[model samples]
Target: MFNMILRVTENPVRRTTARDIAIIAVFAAITAALGLLPAIYLPVSPVPITAQTFGVILAGAVVGGRRAGASQLLFLALVALGLPLLAGGRGGIGVFVSPTVGFLIAFPTVAGLIGWATERVGAPYRLLPGLVVNTAFGIGVMYLFGWVGMMATTHLAPWAAIVALAPFLIGDALKVVIATLTAKGVHASYPGLLRSRTARAVAGAA
Candidate 1:
Protein backbone atom coordinates (compact mmCIF):
# COMPACT_ATOMS: atom_id res chain seq x y z
CA MET A 1 0.00 0.00 0.00
CA PHE A 2 2.80 2.40 0.84
CA ASN A 3 4.52 1.58 -2.43
CA MET A 4 1.30 2.07 -4.33
CA ILE A 5 0.73 5.41 -2.68
CA LEU A 6 4.24 6.50 -3.50
CA ARG A 7 3.85 5.40 -7.05
CA VAL A 8 0.65 7.35 -7.42
CA THR A 9 1.98 10.55 -5.92
CA GLU A 10 5.59 10.60 -7.02
CA ASN A 11 6.67 11.66 -10.45
CA PRO A 12 8.23 8.71 -12.18
CA VAL A 13 11.88 9.27 -12.85
CA ARG A 14 12.62 8.95 -16.52
CA ARG A 15 15.63 9.22 -18.77
CA THR A 16 16.43 12.66 -20.11
CA THR A 17 15.91 13.40 -23.78
CA ALA A 18 17.14 15.96 -26.28
CA ARG A 19 13.93 17.89 -25.83
CA ASP A 20 14.53 18.05 -22.09
CA ILE A 21 18.03 19.31 -22.75
CA ALA A 22 16.69 21.99 -25.08
CA ILE A 23 14.06 23.07 -22.58
CA ILE A 24 16.65 23.25 -19.82
CA ALA A 25 18.97 25.33 -21.96
CA VAL A 26 16.21 27.69 -22.99
CA PHE A 27 15.09 28.32 -19.40
CA ALA A 28 18.67 28.83 -18.28
CA ALA A 29 19.15 31.44 -21.00
CA ILE A 30 15.89 33.08 -20.00
CA THR A 31 17.15 33.35 -16.43
CA ALA A 32 20.46 34.83 -17.61
CA ALA A 33 18.59 37.33 -19.78
CA LEU A 34 16.52 38.47 -16.82
CA GLY A 35 19.73 39.25 -14.95
CA LEU A 36 20.39 41.96 -17.53
CA LEU A 37 17.50 43.95 -16.08
CA PRO A 38 18.89 46.66 -13.84
CA ALA A 39 19.12 45.57 -10.24
CA ILE A 40 17.58 47.82 -7.61
CA TYR A 41 19.98 48.39 -4.77
CA LEU A 42 18.44 48.65 -1.36
CA PRO A 43 20.07 50.70 1.33
CA VAL A 44 19.01 48.11 3.87
CA SER A 45 20.40 44.88 2.45
CA PRO A 46 23.57 44.08 0.55
CA VAL A 47 21.67 41.90 -1.86
CA PRO A 48 20.12 43.79 -4.70
CA ILE A 49 16.64 42.98 -5.97
CA THR A 50 16.70 41.63 -9.51
CA ALA A 51 14.31 40.19 -12.08
CA GLN A 52 16.15 36.86 -12.18
CA THR A 53 13.84 35.33 -9.62
CA PHE A 54 10.98 35.91 -12.00
CA GLY A 55 12.65 33.59 -14.47
CA VAL A 56 13.23 31.08 -11.70
CA ILE A 57 9.54 31.00 -10.85
CA LEU A 58 8.51 30.78 -14.47
CA ALA A 59 10.86 27.84 -15.11
CA GLY A 60 9.26 25.75 -12.39
CA ALA A 61 5.72 26.85 -13.27
CA VAL A 62 6.14 25.95 -16.91
CA VAL A 63 8.66 23.10 -17.02
CA GLY A 64 7.78 20.95 -14.02
CA GLY A 65 10.22 19.87 -11.29
CA ARG A 66 13.21 18.02 -12.69
CA ARG A 67 13.66 20.14 -15.77
CA ALA A 68 13.18 23.36 -13.87
CA GLY A 69 15.75 22.30 -11.34
CA ALA A 70 18.11 21.20 -14.07
CA SER A 71 17.72 24.54 -15.76
CA GLN A 72 18.73 26.40 -12.60
CA LEU A 73 21.66 24.09 -12.03
CA LEU A 74 22.81 24.72 -15.59
CA PHE A 75 22.53 28.46 -15.10
CA LEU A 76 24.67 28.30 -11.99
CA ALA A 77 27.26 26.18 -13.73
CA LEU A 78 27.74 28.85 -16.34
CA VAL A 79 27.92 31.52 -13.67
CA ALA A 80 30.48 29.50 -11.80
CA LEU A 81 32.57 29.26 -14.94
CA GLY A 82 32.87 33.07 -14.79
CA LEU A 83 30.12 34.10 -17.12
CA PRO A 84 28.59 37.44 -16.16
CA LEU A 85 25.16 35.91 -15.75
CA LEU A 86 24.16 37.41 -12.45
CA ALA A 87 22.58 40.77 -11.79
CA GLY A 88 25.02 43.65 -12.31
CA GLY A 89 26.85 41.31 -14.67
CA ARG A 90 28.55 39.66 -11.73
CA GLY A 91 29.64 36.02 -11.88
CA GLY A 92 32.48 33.70 -10.95
CA ILE A 93 33.37 31.16 -8.28
CA GLY A 94 33.80 34.09 -5.92
CA VAL A 95 30.10 34.81 -6.00
CA PHE A 96 29.43 31.41 -4.48
CA VAL A 97 31.17 32.43 -1.26
CA SER A 98 29.60 35.86 -1.03
CA PRO A 99 26.66 37.03 1.04
CA THR A 100 24.28 36.19 -1.76
CA VAL A 101 25.44 32.57 -1.94
CA GLY A 102 22.57 31.27 0.11
CA PHE A 103 20.03 32.94 -2.12
CA LEU A 104 21.97 31.95 -5.20
CA ILE A 105 22.23 28.33 -4.12
CA ALA A 106 18.54 28.37 -3.31
CA PHE A 107 17.68 28.97 -6.98
CA PRO A 108 17.62 25.34 -8.08
CA THR A 109 15.76 24.22 -5.01
CA VAL A 110 13.30 27.06 -5.38
CA ALA A 111 12.61 26.23 -8.99
CA GLY A 112 12.52 22.49 -8.34
CA LEU A 113 10.13 22.70 -5.41
CA ILE A 114 7.92 25.14 -7.24
CA GLY A 115 7.87 22.88 -10.29
CA TRP A 116 7.07 19.81 -8.22
CA ALA A 117 4.32 21.57 -6.30
CA THR A 118 2.93 23.07 -9.47
CA GLU A 119 2.75 19.63 -11.05
CA ARG A 120 0.69 18.35 -8.13
CA VAL A 121 -1.86 21.04 -8.97
CA GLY A 122 -2.53 19.08 -12.21
CA ALA A 123 -3.46 20.22 -15.69
CA PRO A 124 -4.97 23.55 -16.61
CA TYR A 125 -3.29 24.94 -13.51
CA ARG A 126 -5.32 27.84 -12.19
CA LEU A 127 -4.16 31.24 -10.96
CA LEU A 128 -4.90 30.99 -7.24
CA PRO A 129 -3.15 27.70 -6.62
CA GLY A 130 -0.23 28.67 -8.80
CA LEU A 131 0.11 31.89 -6.84
CA VAL A 132 -0.01 30.01 -3.58
CA VAL A 133 2.66 27.50 -4.62
CA ASN A 134 4.98 30.11 -6.11
CA THR A 135 4.56 32.42 -3.12
CA ALA A 136 5.21 29.74 -0.56
CA PHE A 137 8.23 28.18 -2.23
CA GLY A 138 9.64 31.09 -4.18
CA ILE A 139 9.53 33.67 -1.40
CA GLY A 140 9.30 31.79 1.88
CA VAL A 141 11.71 28.98 1.14
CA MET A 142 13.99 31.11 -0.95
CA TYR A 143 14.29 33.75 1.79
CA LEU A 144 15.05 31.15 4.39
CA PHE A 145 18.28 30.50 2.53
CA GLY A 146 18.86 34.16 1.82
CA TRP A 147 18.62 34.94 5.51
CA VAL A 148 21.20 32.33 6.31
CA GLY A 149 23.45 33.64 3.55
CA MET A 150 23.24 37.12 4.98
CA MET A 151 24.05 35.88 8.44
CA ALA A 152 26.96 33.80 7.23
CA THR A 153 28.57 36.56 5.21
CA THR A 154 27.81 39.63 7.31
CA HIS A 155 27.83 37.86 10.69
CA LEU A 156 24.51 39.39 11.58
CA ALA A 157 22.27 38.14 14.32
CA PRO A 158 19.26 36.17 13.17
CA TRP A 159 16.86 38.96 14.00
CA ALA A 160 19.07 41.52 12.35
CA ALA A 161 19.40 39.50 9.19
CA ILE A 162 15.67 39.02 9.04
CA VAL A 163 15.22 42.74 9.39
CA ALA A 164 17.62 43.40 6.55
CA LEU A 165 15.86 40.87 4.39
CA ALA A 166 12.52 42.57 4.90
CA PRO A 167 12.98 45.12 2.16
CA PHE A 168 13.03 42.52 -0.64
CA LEU A 169 9.75 40.90 0.38
CA ILE A 170 7.53 43.40 -1.37
CA GLY A 171 9.41 43.05 -4.61
CA ASP A 172 9.43 39.25 -4.40
CA ALA A 173 5.70 39.27 -3.75
CA LEU A 174 5.12 41.24 -6.93
CA LYS A 175 7.30 38.82 -8.89
CA VAL A 176 5.28 35.94 -7.53
CA VAL A 177 2.06 37.46 -8.79
CA ILE A 178 3.41 38.19 -12.24
CA ALA A 179 5.12 34.81 -12.59
CA THR A 180 1.98 32.97 -11.49
CA LEU A 181 -0.20 34.81 -13.97
CA THR A 182 2.29 34.28 -16.74
CA ALA A 183 2.58 30.58 -15.91
CA LYS A 184 -1.20 30.20 -15.97
CA GLY A 185 -1.29 31.74 -19.41
CA VAL A 186 1.49 29.48 -20.61
CA HIS A 187 -0.20 26.35 -19.31
CA ALA A 188 -3.46 27.45 -20.89
CA SER A 189 -1.81 27.86 -24.26
CA TYR A 190 0.48 24.84 -24.01
CA PRO A 191 -1.66 22.32 -22.25
CA GLY A 192 0.17 19.44 -20.54
CA LEU A 193 3.50 21.25 -20.44
CA LEU A 194 3.78 20.48 -16.75
CA ARG A 195 3.53 16.79 -17.60
CA SER A 196 5.28 17.03 -20.94
CA ARG A 197 8.38 15.12 -20.01
CA THR A 198 6.54 12.27 -18.39
CA ALA A 199 3.89 12.16 -21.09
CA ARG A 200 6.44 12.03 -23.83
CA ALA A 201 8.32 9.21 -22.20
CA VAL A 202 5.17 7.20 -21.68
CA ALA A 203 4.03 7.78 -25.20
CA GLY A 204 7.36 6.75 -26.66
CA ALA A 205 7.35 3.42 -24.83
CA ALA A 206 3.87 2.50 -25.97
Candidate 2:
Protein backbone atom coordinates (compact mmCIF):
# COMPACT_ATOMS: atom_id res chain seq x y z
CA MET A 1 0.00 0.00 0.00
CA PHE A 2 2.82 2.40 0.81
CA ASN A 3 4.63 1.64 -2.46
CA MET A 4 1.42 2.11 -4.43
CA ILE A 5 0.73 5.42 -2.72
CA LEU A 6 4.26 6.62 -3.47
CA ARG A 7 3.77 6.06 -7.19
CA VAL A 8 0.60 8.12 -7.14
CA THR A 9 2.30 10.97 -5.29
CA GLU A 10 5.40 11.11 -7.45
CA ASN A 11 6.07 13.96 -9.86
CA PRO A 12 4.00 13.17 -12.92
CA VAL A 13 6.05 12.09 -15.95
CA ARG A 14 5.42 14.79 -18.54
CA ARG A 15 5.63 14.19 -22.26
CA THR A 16 6.66 17.38 -24.01
CA THR A 17 3.88 17.79 -26.49
CA ALA A 18 4.00 20.54 -29.12
CA ARG A 19 1.38 22.50 -27.21
CA ASP A 20 3.40 22.22 -24.05
CA ILE A 21 6.49 23.49 -25.80
CA ALA A 22 4.53 26.42 -27.20
CA ILE A 23 3.17 27.37 -23.80
CA ILE A 24 6.64 27.22 -22.32
CA ALA A 25 8.03 29.37 -25.09
CA VAL A 26 5.25 31.89 -24.60
CA PHE A 27 6.06 32.21 -20.92
CA ALA A 28 9.74 32.68 -21.73
CA ALA A 29 8.84 35.48 -24.09
CA ILE A 30 6.53 36.98 -21.51
CA THR A 31 9.38 37.03 -19.02
CA ALA A 32 11.65 38.68 -21.54
CA ALA A 33 8.99 41.29 -22.27
CA LEU A 34 8.64 42.06 -18.60
CA GLY A 35 12.36 42.74 -18.51
CA LEU A 36 11.81 45.25 -21.29
CA LEU A 37 9.52 47.26 -19.07
CA PRO A 38 11.05 50.20 -17.25
CA ALA A 39 13.50 49.29 -14.45
CA ILE A 40 14.03 51.59 -11.52
CA TYR A 41 17.72 51.51 -10.79
CA LEU A 42 18.53 52.25 -7.19
CA PRO A 43 21.52 54.21 -6.04
CA VAL A 44 22.76 51.40 -3.83
CA SER A 45 23.10 48.65 -6.40
CA PRO A 46 23.19 47.83 -10.09
CA VAL A 47 20.16 45.59 -9.89
CA PRO A 48 16.83 47.27 -10.55
CA ILE A 49 13.20 46.63 -9.64
CA THR A 50 11.46 45.07 -12.63
CA ALA A 51 8.52 42.83 -13.47
CA GLN A 52 10.54 39.82 -14.60
CA THR A 53 10.18 38.02 -11.29
CA PHE A 54 6.40 38.24 -11.71
CA GLY A 55 6.79 36.21 -14.87
CA VAL A 56 9.02 33.80 -13.02
CA ILE A 57 6.39 33.31 -10.31
CA LEU A 58 3.59 32.86 -12.84
CA ALA A 59 5.59 30.29 -14.76
CA GLY A 60 5.90 28.27 -11.57
CA ALA A 61 2.18 28.24 -10.69
CA VAL A 62 0.96 27.88 -14.28
CA VAL A 63 3.55 25.69 -16.03
CA GLY A 64 4.63 23.33 -13.27
CA GLY A 65 8.20 22.53 -12.21
CA ARG A 66 10.18 20.95 -15.03
CA ARG A 67 8.74 23.14 -17.76
CA ALA A 68 9.01 26.32 -15.74
CA GLY A 69 12.68 25.54 -15.12
CA ALA A 70 13.07 24.78 -18.81
CA SER A 71 11.58 28.13 -19.75
CA GLN A 72 14.00 30.04 -17.54
CA LEU A 73 16.89 27.97 -18.91
CA LEU A 74 15.84 28.90 -22.41
CA PHE A 75 15.64 32.57 -21.45
CA LEU A 76 19.12 32.47 -19.97
CA ALA A 77 20.47 30.67 -23.01
CA LEU A 78 19.09 33.34 -25.31
CA VAL A 79 20.64 36.04 -23.17
CA ALA A 80 24.01 34.31 -23.19
CA LEU A 81 23.99 34.18 -26.96
CA GLY A 82 23.88 37.98 -26.91
CA LEU A 83 20.24 38.91 -27.10
CA PRO A 84 19.61 41.86 -24.81
CA LEU A 85 16.75 40.15 -23.04
CA LEU A 86 17.72 41.29 -19.56
CA ALA A 87 16.54 44.59 -18.13
CA GLY A 88 18.61 47.61 -19.30
CA GLY A 89 19.13 45.69 -22.56
CA ARG A 90 22.09 43.85 -21.08
CA GLY A 91 23.07 40.35 -22.19
CA GLY A 92 25.88 38.14 -23.43
CA ILE A 93 28.19 35.70 -21.67
CA GLY A 94 29.78 38.60 -19.85
CA VAL A 95 26.51 39.44 -18.16
CA PHE A 96 26.61 36.05 -16.48
CA VAL A 97 29.65 37.29 -14.58
CA SER A 98 27.73 40.33 -13.34
CA PRO A 99 26.47 40.85 -9.80
CA THR A 100 23.01 39.63 -10.75
CA VAL A 101 24.37 36.30 -11.93
CA GLY A 102 23.54 34.71 -8.61
CA PHE A 103 19.91 35.63 -8.98
CA LEU A 104 20.10 34.56 -12.60
CA ILE A 105 21.46 31.22 -11.53
CA ALA A 106 18.56 30.87 -9.11
CA PHE A 107 16.00 31.54 -11.84
CA PRO A 108 15.46 27.96 -12.93
CA THR A 109 15.67 26.58 -9.42
CA VAL A 110 13.36 29.27 -8.04
CA ALA A 111 10.71 28.63 -10.69
CA GLY A 112 11.03 24.89 -10.21
CA LEU A 113 10.80 25.19 -6.43
CA ILE A 114 7.73 27.43 -6.61
CA GLY A 115 6.08 25.03 -9.06
CA TRP A 116 6.74 22.21 -6.66
CA ALA A 117 5.16 24.22 -3.86
CA THR A 118 2.05 25.05 -5.90
CA GLU A 119 1.40 21.39 -6.62
CA ARG A 120 1.79 20.48 -2.97
CA VAL A 121 -0.74 23.15 -1.99
CA GLY A 122 -3.38 21.37 -4.12
CA ALA A 123 -6.67 22.56 -5.66
CA PRO A 124 -8.33 26.00 -5.41
CA TYR A 125 -4.73 27.28 -4.83
CA ARG A 126 -5.84 29.88 -2.29
CA LEU A 127 -4.16 33.28 -2.64
CA LEU A 128 -3.17 33.83 0.98
CA PRO A 129 -1.63 30.41 1.30
CA GLY A 130 0.02 30.68 -2.08
CA LEU A 131 1.29 34.10 -1.07
CA VAL A 132 2.79 32.60 2.06
CA VAL A 133 4.43 29.81 0.13
CA ASN A 134 5.77 32.13 -2.57
CA THR A 135 7.07 34.50 0.03
CA ALA A 136 8.81 31.84 2.04
CA PHE A 137 10.33 29.87 -0.77
CA GLY A 138 10.14 31.76 -4.05
CA ILE A 139 11.15 35.26 -3.04
CA GLY A 140 13.24 34.13 -0.13
CA VAL A 141 15.28 31.72 -2.22
CA MET A 142 15.92 34.28 -4.96
CA TYR A 143 16.99 36.97 -2.54
CA LEU A 144 19.39 34.57 -0.93
CA PHE A 145 20.99 33.97 -4.30
CA GLY A 146 20.83 37.65 -5.24
CA TRP A 147 22.67 38.90 -2.20
CA VAL A 148 25.31 36.24 -2.48
CA GLY A 149 25.95 37.36 -6.02
CA MET A 150 26.15 40.95 -4.85
CA MET A 151 28.58 40.05 -2.15
CA ALA A 152 30.89 38.27 -4.54
CA THR A 153 30.84 40.93 -7.24
CA THR A 154 30.95 44.02 -5.03
CA HIS A 155 33.30 42.65 -2.40
CA LEU A 156 30.85 43.59 0.32
CA ALA A 157 30.62 41.75 3.60
CA PRO A 158 27.68 39.39 4.05
CA TRP A 159 26.01 41.78 6.47
CA ALA A 160 26.38 44.70 4.08
CA ALA A 161 24.90 42.65 1.26
CA ILE A 162 21.75 41.98 3.24
CA VAL A 163 21.39 45.65 4.11
CA ALA A 164 21.87 46.65 0.49
CA LEU A 165 19.00 44.44 -0.64
CA ALA A 166 16.41 45.98 1.68
CA PRO A 167 15.25 48.66 -0.75
CA PHE A 168 14.10 46.19 -3.40
CA LEU A 169 12.03 43.99 -1.10
CA ILE A 170 8.88 46.13 -1.13
CA GLY A 171 8.54 46.04 -4.91
CA ASP A 172 9.32 42.36 -4.95
CA ALA A 173 6.59 41.86 -2.33
CA LEU A 174 4.08 43.46 -4.68
CA LYS A 175 5.25 41.07 -7.40
CA VAL A 176 4.58 38.16 -5.08
CA VAL A 177 0.99 39.36 -4.66
CA ILE A 178 0.46 39.94 -8.37
CA ALA A 179 1.90 36.58 -9.28
CA THR A 180 -0.37 34.81 -6.81
CA LEU A 181 -3.49 36.55 -8.12
CA THR A 182 -2.63 35.86 -11.76
CA ALA A 183 -2.00 32.18 -11.19
CA LYS A 184 -5.07 31.76 -8.95
CA GLY A 185 -7.31 33.47 -11.51
CA VAL A 186 -6.09 31.20 -14.28
CA HIS A 187 -6.45 28.14 -12.07
CA ALA A 188 -10.06 29.04 -11.25
CA SER A 189 -11.09 29.54 -14.88
CA TYR A 190 -9.14 26.60 -16.25
CA PRO A 191 -9.07 23.45 -14.28
CA GLY A 192 -6.08 21.16 -14.94
CA LEU A 193 -3.93 24.19 -15.55
CA LEU A 194 -1.17 22.42 -13.63
CA ARG A 195 -1.94 18.98 -15.05
CA SER A 196 1.23 17.66 -16.64
CA ARG A 197 1.49 15.26 -19.55
CA THR A 198 3.33 13.05 -17.10
CA ALA A 199 0.31 13.12 -14.86
CA ARG A 200 -1.82 12.06 -17.82
CA ALA A 201 0.55 9.20 -18.60
CA VAL A 202 0.57 8.10 -14.99
CA ALA A 203 -3.21 8.06 -15.00
CA GLY A 204 -3.21 6.04 -18.20
CA ALA A 205 -0.75 3.57 -16.73
CA ALA A 206 -2.80 3.20 -13.60
Question: What's the CA RMSD of model 2 in angstroms?
Answer: 10.2
Q: 87-163 in candidate 2: lDDT tens per residue?
A: 87888999889877888988888888888888776665678878987887668999999998999898999998888
**Worst window of 10 by summed lDDT in candidate 2:** 193-202
Query: How displaced is residue 165 in candidate 1, in Å?
Result: 1.2
Off by over 4 Å in 2: 1-14, 40-48, 195-206
lDDT of 1 by residue, 85-176 (tens): 99889999999998779988899999999999988876667798898899999998999999999999999999999888887887788889
The true-versus-predicted C-alpha distance at residue 144 of model 1, in Å, is 0.5
TM-score of each: 0.83, 0.80
Best by TM-score: 1
